[model samples]
Target: MRTLTLVRRVAPLILLLVVLAVLTVRAAEQLDNQDTYFHLRFGHELLGEWSLRDPGSVSSFATADWVPTQWLPQITMAAVEDRAGLAGVAWLSGLAFLALALTLYVVARRRVEPLAAAPLTALALVASSSGLSARPQVLSYLLVAVTATAWLAAARSGRTPWWLVPLTWVWACCHGMWPVGLAIGGVAVLATALRPDRRWDRVARGAAVVALSGLATLVTPVGPRLLGAVVAVDERREFFSEWGRPDPGDPRLLALLALLLVAAAALAWRGTDGPRGPRTLRGLRESPDLTALGLLVLAGGCTVASGRTVPVAAALLVPVAATALHRHLGDRPAWTRLEQVVVLGGVALALPVLAAVVPHTADEPPARPAWTDPALAALPAGTPVLNDWNLGGWLMWRHPQLDPVMHGYGDTFTVEELRRNTDILALRPGWRTLVRETGVSYALVRPRSPLGRALVDDEGWRVLHRSPDLVLLKPPPGWM
Candidate 1:
C-alpha cells in the first residue's frame, strides 16, 4: 500500500518533466517556418516605428494596405531576439508550450484523477502539435485553452466569467483569434440556459460576459479596424495552405479523431444502466452537462472546418473529455497542494534547461546556407530578385535592401498580384513576360522549380551558385 501511494505521488511530476524535455528539444531544432522570419523582422520594425500598419515596403509586389494584427507577440519576440538572438526566441517558445501543457493538465485535474487527466492532456497536445510553431498563434492556443476551461467551470458553478473580458483584450493584441473565445462564451451561455436547474439571472449574466469580451477586442491598438484585418485574411484563404481542408491522413487529425471517439464512447456507456441500459434517448440527452456537450459539438465543427482550426478543436475537447472519462473511474480525491507544487515546479525548471541548449541548437535558419549572406549582400539595394513564395520571407528579413516580387503574406497582395505570382512561378503561358516585367536580373529559388528550369533552359541564364536544395542564377547579359 505504501509503494502504490508513493508511486501515485511521484507520477504527475514525472509526466510533466518528460513533456517539458520533449517540447524543449523539439522547439530548439532550427528555425525554419517561413512566417517566423517575417514576424521577427516585422516585430523589430514595429519596435522602431511604433505602428500597426505595414509600410508596404517589405516587398515590391505588396499592393494591399496590410494591418499587423499580431503585433504584441511580434514585438515581444523582436525584443527577445535583440537581446539573446534566435536562441532566446526558441527558449520563449519552449516556455509558451510548457504553459499550454500545464494549463491543460491543471484544468483537467480539477474534475478527473491525475492518471486519467494525464493521458487526455497528452492526446490534446498531440492533436495540437501541428499548430504549435514559434509564432503568435501559440499565444492564441494558450488563450483558447484558458477560455474553454473558464467557461466549462462557469457552466457548473452558475457564475459568469467576468475576467474573460480583459483576457480578450490581451488576446486581440496578440493574435486574430480573440473572437473564438467570445464564441465559446456564447455557447456557454446557451448551455447554462439548458440546465435542469437553470437560473434566468445566471443566463443573463453569462450573456453580458460574452458581450463585454467582444467589446474589449474593439479597444485594442487596431481598434474596430481589427475586424477588417481578420476578414481580409479569410477572403484570401485560397493562397494559404493552413486554411486548406484537414487531411484525413495527418497523424494529428488521427489523434483528434481517436480522442473524439473515446469521449463519445464514454458518454454512451455512462448513459447505460447495467444490461437494461438507458431507457430512452432522453436519458442520454440529459446524462452529461449541456456545457460539455455543446463544447464537444463545437470541437466537431472546428475539426471539419479547416486545417487551421484543428488545434482549436483539440483545445475545446480536452477538458470535456477528461471529465467524461473520469465518470468511469468514479469520484477521486482532488490533487494535494504538494502534488501540484511538484508538478508545476518541475515544469518551471525547463526554462533554464532550454536556455542552455537553444543557443547552440537554434542559431540558424534551416534553408539558409553559409554562403547566402555574403552572396546576397553583394547586390545593391532595390535590386529586384525573382524568388518563389517560400524564399520571400527570408529575403525580406535578411536582405530587405533587395526587393522580392512574391512572398507568403497572402493578405498583403492584391488578387491580381497573387494569381500573377502563381502563374509566373508555375511557368504558365504569360510567365516569360511576367518575369521580364518585374525587371529581375537575379533569381534565388529551387533548381527543380518550373521557373528555375525555364530560366536556365530557355532563357540561358547563367548559374552563379548551385546546391541540391537551391540555386542562384543570373540572367543573360543585357536581358534585364
Candidate 2:
C-alpha cells in the first residue's frame, strides 16, 4: 500500500523524466549533421579571426557572408571541444536539452494540475522532435520556454519581472529568433490588458517591459545586423525546406497535430456554454488569461502546418495543452490504492518501449549517406572545401582543421546564397558553377548524389578516396 501510494504520487513525474531522458539519449547518439559542422567550423574561425568576419580572405567559401547568430551555444560547444573533443560537444548539447526539458516540465507543472502535467510534458517531449538538432535553435527553444513561463507568471500576478529583459538580449545573441521572447511578452501584456478591473498604469508597465525587452534584443555582438540577417533569411522562405508546407505523409507530425486539434476542441467545448451549462462556461470565460493561452495553441497549429514553425509550435503547445487539460480534467477523482499500483506498474512496464520508438521520427537520418570518407585523412592542409549542408556535421567532427564555405547557419546566409547552393547541389548547372566559383580545391560529395557519380566519371576530377557514403574529389594537376 505504501509503495502504491508513493508511485501514485510520483508516476507522472517519472514518465515525464523518462520521456525527456530518452529524447536526450537519442539526440546524442545521432551523427552530427551539416549544421553542426558549420557551427563547429565557425567556432574555430572565431578562435582565429576573433570576429564573425573572415579576416585572411582565405577562400570565397569562408567569406560567404555568414553570421553566427547562435554564437553563445556554438561557443559553448567549441569550448567543450577544446576540453573533450567532438563527443564532448555532443554530450553538452544533450545535457542542455535535458535541462531544457526539465525547465519546461517545471513551468507546465506550475500552470496545471499535477496529474495533467505528466501527459503535457510527454507531448512537449514528442513535439520537440524537430528542434533536437545541434544547432542554435536548441538554445532558442529553451529561451522561449523561460520567456513564456515568466510572462505567464507576470500575467497572473501583474508583476512583470525586470530580469526578463536582459534574458531577451541574451536570447537574441544566442539565436536570431529573439523576437519570439518579445512575442510571448506581448501576448502576456494583451492578456493583462484585457482584464476590465486592471488599471491602465499596470497594463502600460507590462507593455513597456515587452518593448524594452525587444529593443534589448539589439544589444548582441551583431547589433542591428542581427535583425538584417533574420529578415534576409525569412524573406527567402521559398528556398528553405522547413519554410515549405508540411508533408501529409509524415506520420509523427500528423499524429501530434491531430492530438493538438483534439486538445483544442476539448478546451473550447469545456470552456464554452454547452450541454453541461453556462456555469461551466462562466468559469472559463472569466479567466481571460486562459483564453490568451488558446491563442498560443492556434499559433502552434498554424506553424506546425507550415513545417518551418515546428520549434515555435513545440515551445508554445506544451503549456497550452497543460492548461487545457487542467481546465477540463483537474477535478477528476484520484486512483484508489489498488488502481494506483496497477497504473504505476503499467507505466513502469511501458516506459522502455516508448523510449525506444519515440525519439527519432524517421527510420534513418534524413538525406544522409550510409557511410563517409575519413574527412580528416584525405583533405590537404588548408584545403578550401564546398560541402553539402547535410554532411557538414560529419566534416566538422572529422576535420576540425579545414575551413568550409557554409554549413547549416540558415539565418546567416542570404536567400540568394541559399537558393544558389540548393540549385547547385540538387541540379546540374548550379553544381558546376558552384564548384568553379568557390574555387573549391577538394569536394566532399555524398555517394547518392548525381554530382558525385559525375565527378568519378570525369577525368579532370580525380577520386582520391571513396567510401560507400562519401567520395573525396581533387582537381587534376594544372586545373587549379
Candidate 3:
C-alpha cells in the first residue's frame, strides 16, 4: 500500500521531468532563424528608448510610423542577452515552451483527468511546434492557451474572468495577438447569452469583461496606434509563406484535422442513457453546449484562415476536444493534491538544472564569415549594399554601420518596396533597372543565386569576396 501511494506521487513528476528535458535540449540548439537576430536587436533598441517610434537607427528602411506591438518580449530578450548573452536568450525560449505545455495541461485538467489531458496537450504542442520559436509569437501562443482556458472556465461557472481585462493589456505589450484574447471572450459571452437557460446577469457581466479587454489593448504604451500595427503586415502578407493558406501536405495540419474529427465524433455520439431509438421531433430533448460549440466555430475559422492561425486553432481546440473524449470515455477522478504537488514541484526544481546546462549547451548565434569581415569593414559607414533577404538580419545586428536594402520585418516596408525586393531577388523583369535605381554599389548574396551570377557574369561586377555560402561583389565603376 505504501509502495502504491509512492508510485502514484512519483509517476507524474517523472513524466514532467522527461518532458522538460526534451524541450530544454531542443531549445538549446542554435538560433538558426534570421528573425531571432532582428528581434534581439530590436529588443536592445527598445530597451534604450523604451518607445514605439521609428527605430531608424537600427534599420535603414523601416517606416518612421512603425509600431512595436511586441515590445515587451523584445525588451525581455534584450535584457537577458545583455546579462547572459545568447545562452540566456536560448534559456528564455525554453522557459516559454515549458510554460505553454503547463498551461495546456492545467486548462485541460479542469474538465478531464490527467490521463486524457496530458496526451491531448502533448498532441496540441506537437501541432504547434512549427509556430514555436525564439520569437514573440511564442509568448502570444502561451497567452492564447491561457485565454481560451479562462473563457471555458467562465462558461462553466457563469462567472466572468474579469481579470482578463488587465491581462489583455499585458498581452498587448507582449504581442499583436491581444485581439485574439478579446475575441475568445466575446465568443464565450455570445454563447452564454444564446443558451436556452441563460442568466442575463452572467451574460451582461461576461460582455463587460470582453468589452473592457478590448479597451485595454488601446491603453498600451503604443496608444491607439497599436490598432493599426496589427494590420500593418496585411499589405506584405503575400511576401511571407506563413500567411498563406494551409498546405494539405503539412503533418501539423493533419494532426489538427484528426483532433477535430475526434471531437466531432465524441459530440455527435448518443449514449444508451438517451431515450431509445428514433422518435418524433418533440421527443428530442438533448441540448448541445453552446459555449463549446461557439468555441469550436472560432477554432474552425482559424484553421481555414491561414497557416499562421492553424496553431492557434489547435491551441483553442485542445481543451474542448479533451473534454469531449473524457466524457465519451466516462468520468475519472481529477489529479490528487499529491500528484499536483509532485508535478509542479518537479517542474520548479528542473528550472535551475536547465539554466545551469544552457550556457554550455546553447549554441551561440551565427557569426559572419571571418574572411569577408575585413572587406565588409572597409566599406564606408552608411554604404548601401544589396543583400540576400536572410542575411539582412546579420547586417542589421553586426554591421549596423552599413545599410542593408531589406530584412524579414515585413510590416516595416511598403507594398511597393516589398514588391521591388521580390522582383530584384528573383531576378524578375526590370530587376536590373531597380538595382541601378537603388544606387547600391555592392551585393552580398548566395554564391550561386541569380543576382550573384548576374553581377559577376552579366554585369561584369568584381568579386571582392567569395565563399561557398555567400559572395560579395562590387559593380563595375559608374554602373550605379
Candidate 4:
C-alpha cells in the first residue's frame, strides 16, 4: 500500500521534471541572442587592444564615451567563445539555466512541498523562456534570486546583511540592470519594517541595507555615472520595442497572469483555522507591510510597460507564489529512506532519455544575412558604409575593417543620431543627401529594406553586388 502511494506521488514529479529539462534545453537551442556579436566586439577589445576602462573605437561614429553595461559577462562569453566555439556558447547557456533551475527549486522548496514546488518552478521557467539567453541579464536573474533569498534569511533574524554591499558591487560590474537588485532589496526591507510587531531596530537595519545597496552600485570603473548607461536609450524608447509595453499576445505575459491569479487565490485566506489577512499582500500571514506586493507592482509594472522585463517578473513572482502556497501545500506522502533513494535514482536514470528527446540547434541572433561576406570582400578597408541596425555587430566581429553605422547598444548613440540612421533606412525626405552628409558612401542591407528598394530605383546609387537577402550598393563617385 505504501509502495503504491509512493508511485502515485513520484509519477507527476517525474513528468514535471522531464518537461522542465526539455523546455530549458530547447530554449537554449532556439533563441539566438541578437546582441551577442555586439558584446563580442567589446570582448575582443578586452582580449587585446583595450582594457575594461578603455573601450576602443570600433563602432561607427564611436564618439559618445561608451560604457560596457554587461562588461563582466561579455568578457566571460568572449573567453568561452575563444575556447569552445558557438556550440560551447549554447552549452554554457544551458549550464546557466541549470544553475537557475537549482536556485529556483531551493528557494521555492522553502515555502512549499516538493510536489507543489516542482511545477511552480517549472512554470517560472516557462514564463522566462521567451527572454532566456547567454546575455549578461542571465547573470542578473541568478543574482536577483540569490539576493531575495539572502534578504529573506536576514529579515528572519532582524539583522542587516553587510554581505549585500559587496554583492551589489559585483552585480553592478556584471550588468546594467544592477539597479534592479537595490530596488528589490529596498522593497524587501521596507516590507519587513512595516510588520505590525516589528521593532524600530529592524526598520533601521532595513533602511541601512537599502542605502548601502544603492552605494554598492557605484563601485564600478565608471563610478556612479555607470547607471546613466541604463537610461541612455530613454531618448528614443521607440527604437527598442523591448523597453516598450508588453504585447498582449506574448506567451510569457499570459503565463505570468495565470500564475499571479492562482497565487493570489491560494494565498487569499488560509491557516490551521480559516480566514487570513489582506489578499493584496500576496497572502503572507500576520503581515501588512505589503512589501512583497509593492515589489510585484514595480516588477509587474515594468513588465507591462516594457515587455523586456517579463523575466524579472518571472524571477520575483515565483518566489512570492511559493510563499503564498506555503500554508496550503499539504505534506508529502510517507516514504522510507530507501523509498526516497529509489525515487531519486529512478529520476536520475530518466535524465538521459529526457535529454535525447529534446531537439538542439545553434540558432544565433542578428541572424547571418546571406550576402554579407561576399559584399564585405568586394569593399575596401575603411569604407564609410551605412549598415543594418542588427548587421553592424556581425560585420564588426567578422571584418572590423568595415566601419559600422550602429548595433545593439542603444545607449551609445544620441537620439538625433539614431533618428538620422532610421530616416535613411526609411528613405524619408533628404535621405539621399543625408547619406552624403554622414559620409556614408556604401549601404549593406537586406534587399527588402526600404532603402534597398530605393537604391534599386535611384540612378545615383548603383547596386554593386546582390545576395538573396542582402545587397551592397554604392553612391555615385561625385555624390560624396
Candidate 5:
C-alpha cells in the first residue's frame, strides 16, 4: 500500500517533469519570436539612460505612447544573454514551458484522477503547441492557468484569496494580455453566482476579487493607457497574420472539437439507471471544473478569432478536460510495488540520458540568423539598409551600428512606414523610389521576397551577397 501510494504521488510529478523537459528541449532547439531581439534591446536600454518615465522609442518614428508590458521577460532575457549567452536564453525558455505545464496540471489534478490526468495533459500540450514561443504571451498563458486554478479552488473553499488581487498587478506588468486574468476571474465569479445553490458570500467575495483584479491592472507602466495599446492592436489586427481570424485548418481547432465531442458522448452514454455518476447535466453543472470549461470556451472563442491565442485556449482547456475525463472514467487503480520499482528505475536512468542528449548547447539561437550576421559583416558599419520586417529585431541586435529603416517595434513606426516596408517586399509601384527616398542605398531582403526577384532583373542594382535565405542588394557602381 505504501509503495503504491508513493508511485501514485510521484506519477503526476513525473508527468509534469516530462512535459517540462519536452518544452525546454523545444526551446533549446530554437530561440523565440522576431520580437525577442527588440525586447532584449529595450531591456538593455532600461538598465542605462532609458528611463521608464519617458521610455523613448528605438525605431525611426517617435513613439512616446509606446510601453512594453513584457518588462520582466525583456530584462531577464537580456541578463541571461549577458551572462550565459544563447545557452541561457534556451534554459529560460525551457523553464517557462515547465512553469506553464506545471501550473495547468496543479489546477487540473484537484478535479481529476491521477491516471487520467496524464493523457489529457498531453492532448492539451498538443493543442497549444502553436503558441509555444519565448514571448511574454507565454507568461500570460501561465498566469491564466493559475487564475483558472485559483477560481476553481475558490468555488470549493468559498473564500477568494486576497493575494490574487496583487498577482493581477504583476501579471499586467509581465504581459499585454493581462486582461485574460480578469476575464477568467469574471467567468468563475459569474458561474458561482448563477449556481442553483448559490453561496452569496462566495459570490460577493468573487465579485470583489474580479473587480479588484481589474483595478490592479491599472498599476502598470502604461497605467490606464494600456487600454489604448489593446485598442491599437485590435485596430491594426488586419496587418498581422498571427492576429488574423482563425481558420478551420488550425489543428488546435480539431483537437478542441474532439474534446467537446468526447464530453457529449460521456454524457450521452452515462450509466442510464440508478446511482447516476457525475457525468450527467445536473452533476456537471455542479462540478467545480465547469467554471474551467467556461474559461476554456472563452479562450477557444478568442483562438477562433485569432490564431495567436491558441496558448490561452490550450492552457485553460487541459485542466477542464482532465477533470471531465477523470469524472467520466471514475477512479483508476494504483501500481503495485513491482511496477513502482520498475517505473522509478526507468525514470532514474532516463534522466541522465535526457540531460546528455536533449540540450544542444552549441546550436545557434534561432532568433539570431547566422546567415544575416555574416552578410551584414561585409557591409560597412552604419550603412542605411532596407530589410524584411521580421529581421528588424535581428538587425538591431546584431548590427547595432546600422540604421535599420524598420524592425520588430511596430508601434515605433507609423502606418505609412509599415506600408512602405511592405511595398518594398511586395515589389509594389515606386518601391525603388521609396527605397531611395528613405536614403537606403543598400537593401537586405529575404531571397524569396518579390523585391529580391525584382532586384534580380534590375540593371541598376548589384548583388553584394547572395545566400539561399537572404539577398543583399546595392546600387551599381555609377548608380550609387
Candidate 6:
C-alpha cells in the first residue's frame, strides 16, 4: 500500500521534470534558427495589423501569401510580445510545452499506472523535443495532444465530444499539420465503423465525428486556398528536405525507433495467445479501436524512423503507449512499487548529470548583425534582401523593415521556387541567373560555404560584410 502510494505521488513530478529537461535542452540548442525568425516576423506582422498579408512589401516573392496555418500561434505570440517582448515569447513557448507535458501526463494517468506513465512521458518529451521550435510545428504538437486526449476520452465512454470537431477547424487554420489530426480522427472512425461485433449506432456516431472534423478543416481564414497550398506542398516531397524519406543513419532517432518497435512487438506477442496477459487483448481482437491503436503505433514508428516525422511519432505514441501499458499492467503488483521508487530515484539522481551534459550557454553568434552585409546596411530601409535559409529567421526578426526575398516560410514558397533557389546555389549557372533575376541587392551567405567563397572570388559581386560564419555580398555597381 505504501509502495503504491509513493508511486502515485511521484510519477507526475518525474514526468514534469523530464519534460522540463527536454525543453531546456531544446531551448539551449535551437534558439536562433531561420524558422524562429519566420514565426517572429509573423507575430510582428499580425500584431501590427491583424493580417497575414505583408504590407509595404517589395519582394516579388509572394508577399500576399497567407500563412493561415500558423496564424493562431503567431497571434498568440504577438500577444505574448505585447505583454513581455521577445523574452515573453520564449516564456510563452516554454509554458505551452509545459501544458503539453501536463496533457501527456493526464492521458497517461488515464491509461497506465501513474508510476509507469513517467518513462513513457519522458520518452515522448524527448522524442517531441527534437522538433520543438518557435514555429507552426509547436502548434501542431499541442493540437495533436488535445485531439488524442479527446479521442481517448470519447473512445472510453461511447459518446464522442461535439466540441472536438469545431476545435479541429480552428486547428486547421493554425497549422499545416491539420491533416495529421484528421488522420488520427479517421483512424478512430474507421476503428468504430469496422468493429464486427459492435452495434452499428456507435460506429455511425464515430463516423459522423470524423466527417465533421474533416469538414471543419476547411473553415480557415484562407478557406480552400489553404487546402490547395497544403496539397501542392504535400505533392512536392522531392523539393523539401523535411518532406523527404528519413535517413536510416541517424543514431538517436534510430535507437528510439528500435526501442519502440521492440516494445510494441513484445506487447503484441504477450497479448496474443498468452494466458498470463490481461483480458483487454481478448476483447481488443474484435474492437476496431484497439486495432487502430496498433496501426497508430506502427505509423508512429515509421515516423520516428524518419527524422522528419519525429514530432508526429511523439504526438501519436504517448497515449497509445500509455493505453497499452495500462491494459497490460492493470493493477500494480506490490513488488512493482519498489521498482517504481528505484526508477524515480534514479531519474532524480541523474538530473544533475543530464544537465551537465546538455550545453548551458547559447554560444552561437547573434544571427542578424553577424550575417548582415554593410552594403545591405547602407541600402535604404525596406530594401529586399535575399538571404540563406538558416539566416532568414534572424533577418526577419531584426530587420522587419526589410522584406526578405525568401525566409523560412516553408509553405509560402512553391516547390519550383525552392528548386530554383536550391539549384542556383548548388550550381554556378543557376546561381548567377538567380542573382540577376531576383534583383537581389544583397546576398547573405554562410562564410564556410563554397557559394560564399565563389561570391568573394568573383569580380561581378562585392563582399560587403564578413564574419566567422557569415558573409554578405552585393551585385556589382549598376547591377540592381
Indicate which candidate wins on lDDT.
1
Question: 450, model 4: CA deviation in Å?
Answer: 1.6
What tens-digit string does per-residue lDDT give for candidate 4 at 1-480?
998767656754675567545745554464355676777767767777775555666756646666667777777878877875565566656666766766776677666656676676777777777667766777777777677766665655666787888898888888877777887888877777677766787778777877887777766775766767776746668877677787888766777786676566665654343366344332335432255455556656656767677777777776766665654554333444653454355345444433443234553444555666666866788877788787776777778777778776776677777777788877789877777777876888778877777777764578877767888888777867
Ordered by TM-score, highest first, the candidates read 1, 3, 4, 5, 6, 2
Ranking 2 against 3 by lDDT, winner: 3
How close to the true structure is residue 313 of candidate 6, measured as C-alpha lDDT? 73
Residues 107-147, model 5: lDDT tens digits: 55556655556555666677778777666677887887777
Clashing pairs in 5: 24-94, 392-407
Question: TM-score: which candidate is best?
Answer: 1
Q: Model 1, poorest ten-residue lDDT window?
A: 277-286
Which run of 10 residues does model 2 get worst, by summed lDDT? 53-62
1 against 2, candidate with superior lDDT: 1
Query: How do the candidates rank by lDDT, highest first?
Result: 1, 3, 4, 5, 2, 6
lDDT of 3: 0.78
TM-score (all chains, Cα) for each model: 0.93, 0.79, 0.91, 0.86, 0.83, 0.82
**lDDT of candidates 1 onward, in order:** 0.81, 0.63, 0.78, 0.68, 0.68, 0.63
lDDT for each residue of candidate 1 in 1-480, tens digit (9 for 90 to 100): 999987776775567667767787788778778888888988888888656744444777777877778889999999999999888888888888888888888777877777767767788888999988888898887788789889988876766789999998999999988888988988889988888888999999999999998888777877677888887877787877788899988978878997788777766664645577544533343467677778888889889888889988888778877656666665656678877676777677777878888989997777566677889999999888999899998888889798899888776788788888989987889888888888887999888988888888888999998887788899998776
- Per-residue lDDT tens digits for candidate 6, residues 124-174, read 766666666656677677677667767766666888767878888887777
Weakest 10 consecutive residues of candidate 6 by summed lDDT:
357-366
Q: Candidate 4: which stretches are off by over 4 Å?
A: 1-8, 27-31, 270-289, 330-371
In model 2, which regions exceed 4 Å deviation? 1-8, 27-30, 52-59, 62-66, 270-294, 305-308, 329-380, 400-406, 411-415, 428-434, 458-460, 475-480
| Cα lDDT tens digits for candidate 3, 71-122 | 8898999899999988888888888888887887787777766656666677
Compute the lDDT for candidate 6: 0.63
